[model samples]
Target: MRSVKTLLVPYYEHPTERPDAWDALLAAADRLYGVVLNPASGPGAAPDPAFAVVAGRLRAAGVRVLGYADTDYGRRPHAAVVRELLCHRDWYGTDGAFLDQVSAEPEALPHYRRLAVAARTAGARTLVLNHGVHPDPAYAELADLLVTFEGPWDAYGSLAVPLWTAAHPRERFCHLVYAAPPDAHVAAAVQCVVPGAGVHPWGTLPHALEPIR
Candidate 1:
């Protein structure tokens, strides 16, 4: 069996909601590839002091701490997106940016590419594009990782990877399934994912966010 070290968590809630959960997540940081720390609305300018502490802790443990920034499906202005990336870097010292709500359209490719560059310029070491689906193959070159699947277990079970994606490293892809069943079900879901791809299964809303032991 492949080790679950490839897990990448979407940890979208504020640190204050569940401080214990955040502690648990940091404890198992070595097993994870990274985590997305999203504030209430979006990547706000003023950083939450609590989040800064959490982000620093994760980074200290060698876990990649990523700041979340919504692209609004590529409709939002480029300058606005870049500002969020900068805030993540300057405020929380996040190692990367999780560009959420990304578009799969070919035209939107340039938009994301630009953001990726801006993120790197602002000290972002990694760039993850959350398309939540298999996007045009051209998007593969724009970021370090791509979220190819984001939904419930049943839908994820039927997910089919495009042939083109096979040409890229499996590690470049990620899969997220919410409302997961028991341990056996989670194991089954991981089996369905391509080898080397990151996979995470959450059990409830405000997801359990437990470490996969």
Candidate 2:
């Protein structure tokens, strides 16, 4: 089956401080389906009111925002920590939650399962687990979609692409990377991996993978 494509747009501006950042995002937003409000970096850090300010604007502009909560950022228990994040859905009015820093261990699946269930119960329409590597089939089945590979530009072609292509139904996967690369790089990567694998260009603009296209 062909996969759906999506681009990951940043929560707000670019990390490098580009003035055209908002324009770039708005221009790409209509071309994509969703955006991720990642508070993990940039101005997303806590005590920075920019997250809410930017996320609110994105929502008003008609983009589906998914909050990024890095479980590994603080070396704490994910469930208890994530349970607190669920409230962000209400605050941000986001469509779902994307759990970053996901563990790859088979034993970790149970914890993720619990989180997935919690996300749904909290009325999250989507749940994404960022495993940072090619998804294990067992882990893939647990969440709505899995973030299989998140690495540097140099490794994207040699490592991530091959690892991703080996898996089928790429439509249900996500690749999170910096946007310093061109759109063609993203386009090619998406096509080479899973015809339908969603691309998070600049980690925000979401373009659906349409195999038929």
User: For model 1, which pairs clash?
Assistant: none
Cα lDDT of model 1 by residue, 89-200, tens digit = 8888888888888998898888888888888888888888888899999998889888887776666678887899879777888876665554414322111121112343
Best by TM-score: 1
lDDT of 2 by residue, 140-202 (tens): 767777777765555566653445345656567666554333443643322222211235334
Global lDDT of model 1: 0.73
Give the true-structure RMSD of model 2.
7.2
Q: How many backbone clashes are present in model 1?
A: 0
Best by lDDT: 1
What is the TM-score (0 to 1) of candidate 2?
A: 0.69
Candidate 1 at 123: error in angstroms?
1.3
What are the models' TM-scores?
0.85, 0.69
User: How much is 91 displaced in model 1, in angstroms?
Assistant: 1.0
